[model samples]
Target: MRDEQDDGRGAALAELRGRLAASVAVARLNRTQLAARAGLGRTTVSEALSPNGPVPSAETVAALAGVLKLPPGELLALHRTASAPHVVGDEGTVTADGPGRAIEGYSPHDLEVHPAGPGRIASGCGGVGGAQELPGYVSRGHDRVLAGAVSDAAAGRSGIVVLVGTSSTGKTRACWEAVQPLADRGWRLWHPFDPTRAQAALEDLHRVTPRTVVWLNEAQHYLGDRAFGERIASAVHQLLVSPERGPVLVLGTLWPEYAHRYTVLPAPGSDDLHSRVRELLSGRTLPVPDAFDSQALAAAAALAENGDLLLADALTRARDDGRVTQDLAGAPELLNRYHNPRTPAAKALLEAAMDARRLGVGPHLPPAFLTDAAIDYLGQTDYDQLTDDWAETAYAELAEPVHGKQAPLRRTTPRPSRRSPAPAIAPQAESRLRLADYLEQHGRTARRHLCPPASFWHAAHTHLTHPDDLNNLAQAAESRHRLQWAHHLRHRAADLGNTAALYRQAEHRDAAGDQEGAEALLREAADLGNISALYRLAVMRERAGDRDGAAVLARRA
Candidate 1:
């Protein structure tokens, strides 16, 4: 009987191995390439593929399956089958008997709730002191819409509710509050984030059952992948339309830029990059305003009267413009820290992060980049006064969370591989940091007209990887009439396959009377599927009296 059991397990292992090998072949990745991409050692990859090897660990299988574009859930199931001992009367069927079994991804009850703010401390009579625990949820206009949608989901109508707003505008808080009742009703909340946003969604979205809340906080991460965003959007649309998947509420939050990108229609003859995303988002978005209006503020004041000191303080401290959400998010506290940093080095570090963010750099700022850029904010006297470990001390101070909530600069863990579940291979000695959302937004206004110094431009050129950011900096440089910097940065962005940068570079070349250079760039952009570039080339051809070439280009466009 033991021997028969061993044979069954071996067969399962062999089946898993065969599936993995086939998937690798289809993906056209050898063991070495697969290992490198998956952030796993080559030896691990080889052993997992060996026919006679033991069942791979769950993480190993997930990493490989993610790299191969196979469903990690299905692959992990196979791994479990091979590893788990077969019990009599135990079948492979999963039943919705409890929270553990019912949830496909993460259980709503298991999620760590974000702090609302400091509650009223126990004081004499109506005295409000320091914050104690989380404050009461102050009702807002969007909350009403969110509640109605949640109610609809409870009543067997699955729908998506996307809250669109800027940073620190309480979009996430609203979504978190909306899904609370679902947890009590045995509804599962699946927030896919293990391997990668797009990969995790593609792998597990199909299996999302009814009465589940698909939490897509920062929805751009899931729907911004050029390769898979449309596919994920299609899957989401399918999830909504399928009658068998009733009572599933797909909730998402998005910044305005991301919302615009997904919803805005392209011009005629241009590629429709976000058609599926538009379809998925059509008529389902609820705009969460950045500031509370008078009516909302009045309601919050009512809540403040009920001993919610956080609300009371926010009401007292809120500017005339009504930045109550930012106050609640410790935005003022973050700014205070920035203004009154313990040391000049710390202040310089904060300034560097703020400048980088305002200049359109991505959220994750490397320590090295910050260190390199911060020097430009300091004078030679200040720089000479710095200790050997000044950078370390400064980062530690700024990265500390204020009010037990937001920080001036928050440390970020190394992200998992884009193609696999495993954490990407990165140096362990230093961590990346991101400026607080509130600071990033504030700096955009405060530093809008300020061009970064030479050191900033140099450090960004050395450390920045995203083409969009490079293009943005290039545009900034061009606006400041720093032509040399603009030319180099724009060229780098174009080289990185940014078609928009290619179009912009062509325009710059044309403006400089370098018609040949412009035409060459336009041709490259047109080949890379930029319809604007094709149209521009058509115009150029017509101007050059190549009527036949012009006609062909126009027709192609």
Candidate 2:
């Protein structure tokens, strides 16, 4: 029975291969051409059609069927012998339909039809997932807050919406949902949600698309550094009111002072915040007592570790001098000096920090709650050391609980206190110190060592392990001095399974005289979904013999 089944399967496979070969021939395209379109190499096409061809992968079959303009089901069915019964195992089975399969694209109708489940909730920063519903926006008290903010912005005829709340308060979820309509309306919207990733992307956006709606979530952290903040603010202003690219509707969620300083929108009402919080917790049962207090306690704990009284005095002096809290980015140093000297100001800052840690200030409090002086003073010293101390204190506090109890350590991660940085130094001096600073902070060497005189080619070769570097190398290879180095780097990197480098390596090989090697490299890259590699492989396959195989691969490429 097994032999019969195997033979039937083999015969079916042979029949399908013959039919596919005939179809390619009838199409009047060579194997290489087909391979080029299909994104496969000549050899790959040849192997697939060979008498001892391996069982096709689902992805490969889909690629081939897509290129051949044939139903994957039809081709798959043709591979089953008439004498053998088709059996689907217990594993999840894929059913392929006829040709001309309808492709799914971005559509509002489709989005609406798709079930909107309780969305994956997350906050912009330190907070983890919140209760299913948000506390304010759609909730009674929170609804008022959302409505007030939205209404104020709407009344002012602002094109943007700003939702502000503390961490884990569902600000991210609210903003994400609120912006869906913008996307549906075909408006390009961007967010600076992830600092490390978004900064690079935003730089690209500034270079390319000038006027784009930017929804900045947690705008404070990114703009916390005065220079950095000012640069970003300047960019925002240009996007908003520039003649060349003006009026990019900007909505941002931030602390009150930061919002007022950076945004054109009005503040959201208190009713909205309360209603939203209530609504988010409506369906669910949680210990709602002291919810706000708990957050305050967390904040206070953070404050006590680093902030002191001297910082508060410096902050007051700066404020009295008519400096905006946004500009008070540098007042911490004065506070730090006074506090360390056992001055009355230092005593006051410590008292405030202790109060902040114990009593917890509500979100409704002014930015003065986390004063510029306190933030700066805290930032000047090692918060990490303070954190280490805090962690130790917490561990000791919790140690007594498990002493006589059978329970293991709860494995809780303490909340990190958010502290601002020290005052900025001169730009030129800062730039000169950056390398040493980075090495000291991160314990790593800077990439500047890769290239002397900073040639694109040199930098590319040194960072060949990076795909972007390989791309840079490829582009630089067009220049006389960089060609050999680029090719060499790409060739080495390709061997390490870097797809971009592999594609570049194939190009270099083709430019050199190794057609076969180039074709092979392209095939490998194509299999990994490198479109350029697939395109190259198809061309190479056609040049080599096997017109039928080339035609199939070309379609796929």
Candidate 3:
């Protein structure tokens, strides 16, 4: 008996043959001429363009659009429809008729990867020796999703599951665990969600064997992008509702921000195609949770010790800023300990040390500056060395305060107390007080050797009062690959009316991947008569293919 899949596909080909003949006539060409334009042999084009029983190859269909001047996308849709066993039904639905041979363009090689364990997940990278290896998967915060998918697949229902989360969150692990139980039950796994090849890959998945699990990992570019999202959403809708398209489950993951981007509706109260998918997936959608369980907590603790991003050098070490809290879980029940200085001299010196530590680390402060800041802090607090308060009488017993500059900075991080905050935010450059003053006040050698707390520059754009010092410091930090510190000082200098600072700030921002911010700063500096900024804009315009704009900028420069 002829298979129903073959019959439905035959019907589709009959329709395609008629369309192909019409397209040829529209292009005013016979098979020979069409074959010449398409760069295929006359016989090959004849066989593919035939309106009878034989189906055309996808590549041939792809060629026809350019040869016949038909829209490429329209021909692609037709190719996708005719090549897949899931026959396109009325109104663009994929309905399965019966089992048939896999569609053309679908690579069936290596369809199954041996499972390491029952719940193991495959992360394409980041293994022990950097070799690809399956690891036991943790389905953290996705219990409901895993259960729903397992229940639905076991019941022979086909639908889409979208797992949304931020970067490095375990969306892949969760979905792998969701489909693990089905893997042993003869369901084949396929990935149809590659960002660069998303729409094209979907055509391949459409032709795969029935009872397959389609993984659309990180599919935000396809489903969330404004330009291509609607077409993808329509494709997904058909994949879900078409009964003829056998029992296949679609698994996908995306960032939450991308997910929300597609929530826009087409009209008032009417959901758009992307929104429609969310409606279809009503209860099955899963978002990665911020909360953690005991097992997750243990795993996170382990990762904290061994795992880190590429910026390993940027990481700050743990700082013990004099406050002490202890929890020795295995110790005696009544055991307790307190941390504090025992002597008056120790207390005074320790307080000053804490103040010094509060200063920034990248631009280390010299001993002279730290000594001044510390002594100033002590004086403001009325910390006298005598009788626990500094007085003229105690000066005889205690030697004159020596600077910490002689010793390398053992600590650079300081804690924020209720009374004081770090110099994370500073005031205007024209303020009466100045943070860069601390970095200044000394000759070039002292300025070069010491780092100042951010607060030193904050609450005042010392650049207004100390432009020469800031320019030197910013350049030094930039040369050391400390772009962040350099950018901070340049920002203050720019606020202090330094047009050169604006251009430098833009350059640093561009290096740090803030192109828009950099461009904005560049424009500001260009308007402020910075020739370097104008030259950079000209180079940028030339690279962006705005030749006329580049010429204009170059002329201005």
Which pairs of residues clash in candidate 1, taking residues 3 or more apart in a chain or in different chains?
none
Best by lDDT: 1
Question: How big is the positional error of residue 15 in model 1, measured in Å on the Cα after superposition?
Answer: 5.5
TM-score of 2: 0.24
Model 1: per-residue Cα lDDT at residue 516: 99
lDDT of 1 by residue, 186-300 (tens): 6767777655777667655755666778888888988878867998898889879977555689888888999998999999999999999998899999998878889878888
Worst 10 residues of 2 by lDDT: 430-439
Estimated TM-score for each candidate: 0.49, 0.24, 0.42
**Residue 94's lDDT in candidate 2:** 14
* Candidate order (lDDT): 1, 3, 2
Model 3 Cα lDDT, one tens digit per residue, 1-557: 23666665666676666777898888788888988888665765787766642455455676776777667676667566666664353332334432222222122112222222112233443223322233333346576766687678656677778877664345565665576577556456666543344544433444544566766676775666555555556666676676656567777777777677655456787745576555644665678753345665454345435652111111111012200000101011111100122333333332333333332222333333333333333443354543534322222222221121111122222322344554453432221211121112121333345444444333123322444445555665566666676777666667766777877778878899887788889998888778898899899888878999999999999
lDDT for model 3 comes to 0.51
TM-score pick, better of 1 and 2: 1
Off by over 4 Å in 1: 1-133, 332-557
Candidate 2: regions farther than 4 A off: 1-162, 193-198, 205-212, 243-247, 256-557
- lDDT pick, better of 1 and 2: 1
